[model samples]
Target chain A: MTFIDMLGAAERQNHSMLCVGLDPEPARFPGRLAGDASKIYDFCAAIVDATADLVIAFKPQIAYFAAHRAEDQLERLMAHMRRVAPQVPVILDAKRGDIGSTAEQYAIEAFERYGADAVTLSPFMGFDSVAPYLKYHGKGSFLLCRTSNPGGDDLQNQRLASVDGQPLLYEHIARLAQGPWNLNGQLGLVVGATYPAEIERVRAVAPTLPLLIPGVGAQGGDAAATVRAGWRPGAPIIVNSSRAIIYASSGDDFADAARREALRTRDVLQAARADSLRVATP
Target chain B: MTFIDMLGAAERQNHSMLCVGLDPEPARFPGRLAGDASKIYDFCAAIVDATADLVIAFKPQIAYFAAHRAEDQLERLMAHMRRVAPQVPVILDAKRGDIGSTAEQYAIEAFERYGADAVTLSPFMGFDSVAPYLKYHGKGSFLLCRTSNPGGDDLQNQRLASVDGQPLLYEHIARLAQGPWNLNGQLGLVVGATYPAEIERVRAVAPTLPLLIPGVGAQGGDAAATVRAGWRPGAPIIVNSSRAIIYASSGDDFADAARREALRTRDVLQAARADSLRVATP
Candidate 1:
């Protein structure tokens, strides 16, 4: 199945918009893990087991893995995921962007080597940089439109005089989305939930495109507002929460706290979706 | 010694601004080394042995090695570099950028695990994102300011209304370099030699910061113009050439051709430096 279909099925099956971020920091990990690859794998597996019913997807930040030269750890993590919950779509958050040939290699690594259903990319390198990944036929690729970082406005909101005069950088990226670049219809945009106004604007421009929304819980982004901003009838939107859910409790009951957080996030998303449906009916 | 001091020493000793980029594409490699890691080791070792005298530094783009998950090849590549030319500085071209903790892990990998003299970074995550790498004290971290890619203008040139009411994204990054972020004073900027004007502009903004100028030869970036734009008296400016040198010949004499190209590039750079010196003295 295509990444979109997988995501839609997962969302419908789980009835959740929550995409748990598996950002395992060696320093912040509970003493039990203690920088051991096996222990790290165990921690992630337990969290996945607990929250699998409450999340549509899993987003693992590749940097956390690459930092450790933890190739073995990554393989183990993938094995654990495949065994425990094969249905949950894993979205690898790599933010990789490079020239065409190199980008092809990255695509292979993300899709074939790691078996990620989707991956995030930095669109700063232009459309061609992402062309190789998009060529994966069924795999999904999310381009960074508006990030959750404080300095996001430093460039994303710049008013550029393009053919469509006075357009922001994000707007330009959205406009490009309408071209042949979205060929396989697997293109998605990462419009941060932190920027609801911009999210609304991007939605208006590319209504059909799926959105991988980050920055909900610990990032102080409003989950309700983000759900409202990105809500489209039956469209896929993965609202990710990392630290708030995964590290809810660093103690022995960390997995339980994570489950509780995931459950709450899913409940809120379902409530928002119901409200949107009600308003549309009226 | 500081990264700047090491760069200065290398520049004087080699009498060249050339940084040979070891972007070994497995498919494009020559000889019996086809898809083999030992061949890559031999190829790189031969190039280093022949050209270490002509160039100040070697930049191995991580994507090349990373694409091939052949650990034996990577280990051999590193071992060859250590054994063949210990004096030449190796700048690992991995554009890594993550939050503080993850960034620290990357710093450890680049400086400790891989033993690279410097590593390139993508500064989109903001100043704090790269702070961990800068905290390495003596290791150099080159921030991506102006990339050689065509779509580089998408965000790097975006204008923003800061407290001062006028700040371009690249300029904002440059300004950040001047503040406390330079705690270790090991900050460097990556301004592609493709844009001479922007190179001059960035140089003017942060004169003291070393510039890792990529995009010469095959990328159509002019080395002489870049030297004119960024050359400072006794400052470190590594003009990198990857494909133009490494892939100079696909035949069995490929290593010799690589050496020849490296010599030619070094001579051109030395001439540019000499011209700049004369201009400065007069």
Candidate 2:
């Protein structure tokens, strides 16, 4: 299935918009799990077992896998997801950007090699750099529109004079949602939950595209505010919680704690969605 | 040694400013070599052996390795560079960017896991995103400035009103070379050779910083024009030619042909530098 279709089914079937970020650091794993090459896959496998029915997707950050020379563990994790839960897609958060030919190689790295249903990319070099990723017609490409970081304002917040009303760079990029940049119908933008108003702006620009919303939990973003500002009836905004959910406890019951955190996040999202529905009724 | 120090030593000893990009593709390789998983390593080993003395640095684009699921081959390639020619540094063209924690993982992947002397970065997420890679005090981080791609105008060419003269986005990033961005003194920028005038602009802004220039060989960028526009006395601006150098011949003599191509590129750069020196002698 196409990534968006799968994401829709997962969100509907699970009744959740929460995306569990499988970022397993060796230092923060459970006490039962040995901090070795296999720790990442084992910890993630247990967590997936505990919370697979509660999340719409699993966003695996590539850095943690490569940091410990645990790439074979990453391969095993993808295979586990495929074998155990095919409905929940895996969005590899690589955030890679390069030229045409090099970008094509990166696409193969994300999809053909690593088996990601979608991959996040940096759009610093513009359309041609991201074009190669879009060629995987079945896979989704999440461009970094307004990232959720303390230093995100360094360039993305710069106001461009050529644009009408002199919108910020992120807004200008969001406007491209209606342009030829999304020719393949598989393009999405990453609008961070930390800035709820910016999320609203991006939603206004491209209401049809899916939004991967990070910065909701540990980054101190208000979950209700994020849903009220960004969420809609049909738009699937996958809100992610990495540390607050996955590493909720370091004890023997880490997986159960993870499930509790994920369940709480899902309930928060559901409550917000219901409130939005109430306000929408005229 | 630091990236700049090693690059300077190699350039002086070899009397060349050429950087051989070892981006091996199985489909484009010579027929004599078997298309097994190790072909990338064997081909690159031969190419490196043939042209070790003809160039200053070796840049291995990570996409080629990751595309074929030959990351182990990449590890082998880095080992080969250390064993065969320790003087010439390897600049891994990864162009990765993310938040602080995720970026730290990528830094570990590039420097600790694969043993790259330097890795390319994208400045989309700002200083903090590029800061983790800088923590590796001995390693180099090349930020994406004016790339050699067709869609560079998408955002890199936008004029920001916040600047004094409404400079292009790439120019603002170039100005960072003079600020707190290079606190580690191991930073560089990737300015494509496609636009010779843009090369001059970057050199004008960051006179002391080294520039890794791509688009010279196969992307229709002129070698002499690039050198004439970018070369300085103490500053080393590396001119890269990947396909044009490595795939100079498709037959069994591919390594020898690659050497010839590297030698010719070095001569072209040398003549341009001489012309600039004679013109400035007055």
Candidate 3:
């Protein structure tokens, strides 16, 4: 199935919209999992097992595993996702962009090698960088729209000279996502939850596209406000919470804590969506 | 010494401006060196040993190594650069970007783990993402400005609403590199050789900063035009060629062929720079 259909099935099955980010820092992992490859595997494995039913997707930040040279651990995580929670998609948050040939290598690495259902991309190099990734019709690619960082405003928020109207640089990108740049129908945008107004702007342009909204947790984004601004009535929106859910605690109860946090966020997202629907109808 | 200083010393001594790209692929290696870790290591080792003195920098595109799960091979390439061509800096062409914390992990991956003297960065997420990589005082970060692809025009070339005289997106990024964004004076821009006009535009703005110009060989970039457009006398600019140089021949003489191709590109670049210098003089 296509990534959208896969996501739809999972959302309907679980009645949730939570995406748990697996950004495992060795220092932040529990004491038992420190300095051991097997332990790292077990930590992620248990977390996945504990929370598989509570969420729609799992985001594995590529840098966290790659920092420790634990690509194997990430591969194992992908394997576990397939074996246990095949319905829930795995989005690899790599944010990589490069020239076409090099991007082709990354495409194989992300999809063919690591088996990610979706991958986050940086749109700096423009369409050629994204083209190789888009060829995988079965998968999905989320381009950075308005990022959720203080420094993000530096470039992405620049006002572009009028084409049809005086839109910000990110708006131009959103239009492109809804335009020719999006060759396949599997394209989405990553509008950080910290900037709900920007999310609303993006939502208006790309009405039906899936949006991977991060920054709702540790980044200090108001979750309810973000959901209200980000949700499209029947759209597939995955709100990601990495640190808040995955590292909910560093003790032996880490897995259980992760499940509890994910469950809570899932419910909150559902409630916010319901409220937004009511407002729209009334 | 900074990456600029190292590259400058090499350029002045070698009288060459070519930067060889070491994007090794295992399947393309000589028949003898196949199906082993030693094959991947040997391919890069042989190429570097042959071309170390012919060029001022060696750019190992991280995806080429990471795709094959030969990150250790990449580590070996970095080590080999330090040991053999200590005067020549290695630019880790990862083109990585993310939010601050994730950027920190990537910074550690490139600078701390791989020990690269410089890295290529995607400017999509703006300052905070680039900030972590820039924290390495001794290292250099080459921000993507105008990439060498048809699809690059989709975003980087958009005319920004005049914050500073209606400059294009890439130009704004270059001006930012010269102004407040370049904290420690080690920032550079990647203006692809394919777009000589954009290269000239970036060079005109960031006069003294290094420009990592790719697309010189297989990407249909005019080497002479690029050298003329990109060269700033007494500036440390690098022109990169990957597939054309590294995979020049899949035969047993691959390393030798690569050296010959690199030496030729180096000489042509030198001739172009000298002509430009003569024009500027009298």
Residues B145-244 of candidate 1 have per-residue lDDT tens digits of 8776776776677665432546666776777775656778888888888889898888877878888998998888988888888888855789999889
Which candidate tops TM-score?
2
lDDT of 2 by residue, A1-282 (tens): 899899999999999999999888888887877466567888989888888999999998888987887778888999999888889999999898987778888898889888999999888998998888888888998989998687799899999988788989998888785467987887888988888998999998888889999987888889999999888888879999999988999897999999999999999999999999999995
Clashes of each: 0, 0, 1
Q: Candidate 2 residues B1-282, lDDT tens each?
A: 888889899999999999999888888888687466569999999999999998889999888888887889889999999888999989998888887788888998999888899999999999999889888877988899998788998999899999888888998898885467998888889999888999999888888888999888888899999988888898788888899989999889998999999999999999999999988885
TM-score of candidate 1 against the unseen true structure: 0.90
Q: What is the TM-score of chain A in candidate 3?
A: 0.97
Arrange candidates by DockQ, descending.
Answer: 2, 3, 1
Between candidates 1 and 3, name the one with more favorable DockQ: 3
Model with the higher lDDT, candidate 2 or 3: 2
Question: Could you give the CAPRI-style class of model 2?
Answer: high
Model 3 segments more than 4 A misplaced: A34-38, B30-38
DockQ of every candidate:
0.39, 0.88, 0.77
Worst 10 contiguous positions by lDDT, candidate 3 chain B: B29-38
